[model samples]
Target: DRSARLPPYGKKRLKTCSFTFRNALLNIKEELQKAISTMTARATHSADVAANTSKNVAEKLDLALAIDKRISKLASQAIDYSSQLSGFDSGLATQMASFQEQMSQIKRELKEGLGRLEHVTANAESAGWYFNDCTC
Candidate 1:
């Protein structure tokens, strides 16, 4: 949103757009095709008023379609490198969570193993005065 805050080379703002970067042009192209078909269907439309109305509608349709196309192109250019931009944050967070779980498991295992070692060490330290002095 803060395009002014961005550097000159990176003047992109991923705003809430009606059409996404990937499919806006295709959608505008489809709309233009439909408008052209509508115009052709009225080919037999005789009368000056009818022809004027059709031309006006066609011009409006073309203008709308051109605006959408331009917007789509600009957005696509801005977003082409956007795949790994903020998109990887989600995947990275998931991996970090997995790593943390693994680390916690290792810590638990170490704690258990250390508890066993301390028990053995305490028994060995006290064994010579109490047991049969057996080294086994």
Candidate 2:
């Protein structure tokens, strides 16, 4: 009777060990699937970042070209403005010179007229007598 009881206990121990093995295998399979999915997500994210970086670089290059063109255009405009300003300065200088010449002529005429009037006044004061600088 004791020998029959030992066989049943041995069968029970065998069944328990098989169940534990199956559960462990299932856990391992689930963990491996999760790791594969994480890796795939990371790869896709990296690809998207690289593509965006290329697009940003292209946009920057185009903007730089546009800025260069604007700078060149502004430089041309500045040169034209300087040339016009020089012409205006030259014209102003010429006009100033002409005005100075006219003013000098007016001063000379005034001095001659003043001298003539003073001589006439002196002659009338002497009753039709004329006198001038003379040497004996």
Candidate 3:
């Protein structure tokens, strides 16, 4: 009587096991999709960062080169200015020496003229005394 009352159990158990397997597969697929999406986003972000960094480094190098060129030009200009100033100093010194020589010559001439004037005065005085003695 018990055996006749017992219901079949194999089909119902198989159905339940198949449903659990399907749910497990679905969950694994969702996790894989999420992982793929995350990896792709990270790759894109990393590429962008690398590109921007390269561009910035290139720009900075260019700026540094420009600054170096400017400094070299300025240094050359300073050297030229120093050379010109040195030439001017030498020329000025030569001119001052010439002026000093001319001044010395002028002083000598003045002294000669003074001596001549004194000699002329002595001659005039002698002539006046001779004229007075003859008139008296």
Candidate 4:
């Protein structure tokens, strides 16, 4: 009855309007789908990038920890070597002092022996024990 009330030109115009509206709704739906797909792709790419960055950071952290451990070990070894060197220096100093004392004692003994030899030589010359006159 409503269609019968409309003029013949009005019915044709209504049909055209309906078709245009349907086409517009379809276009809107396609644009929404494209936007969702683009957003999903971007999200996936961002996730991959974030994962790689996290892995790199973890590897770098591990390397830093290993280096720290090595440095600590080296420091400990250096301390041990320093202690050994200190002990060696102390021992060397003590040995040098002992050697000096022994040298001093030897020097004193040599001087006393030289003096006794000089006295014996003078007594022998006064007693006429000349080397040339002795016929052995």
For each candidate in turn, the TM-score is 0.39, 0.58, 0.62, 0.75
**Model 1: per-residue Cα lDDT over 14-132, one tens digit each:** 44242365478788889999999888666645456688998999999999999999999989977875766667887899999999999999999999999999999888879855666
The local distance difference test score of model 4 is 0.94
lDDT by residue (1-136, candidate 2, tens digit) is 5445768877687668778888888889888888988998998899999999999999999999999999999999999999999999999999999999999999999998889888878777675443333232
Winner by TM-score between candidate 3 and candidate 1 = 3
Worst 10-residue lDDT window, candidate 3: 1-10
Determine which window of 10 residues in candidate 2 has minimal summed lDDT. 127-136
**What ranges in model 2 sit over 4 Å off?**
1-37, 124-136
What TM-score does candidate 3 reach?
A: 0.62
TM-score attained by model 4: 0.75
Candidate 2, TM-score vs. the true structure?
A: 0.58
lDDT of 4 at 37: 92
Per-model lDDT: 0.81, 0.86, 0.89, 0.94
Name the best candidate (by lDDT). 4
Q: Give the per-residue lDDT digits (tens) of candidate 4, residues 52-78.
A: 999999999999999999999999999
Native-to-model Cα distance after best TM-score fit, residue 9 in candidate 4, in Å: 3.1
- Tell me the alpha-carbon RMSD of every candidate: 36.9, 7.5, 5.7, 3.5
lDDT of residue 101 for candidate 4: 100
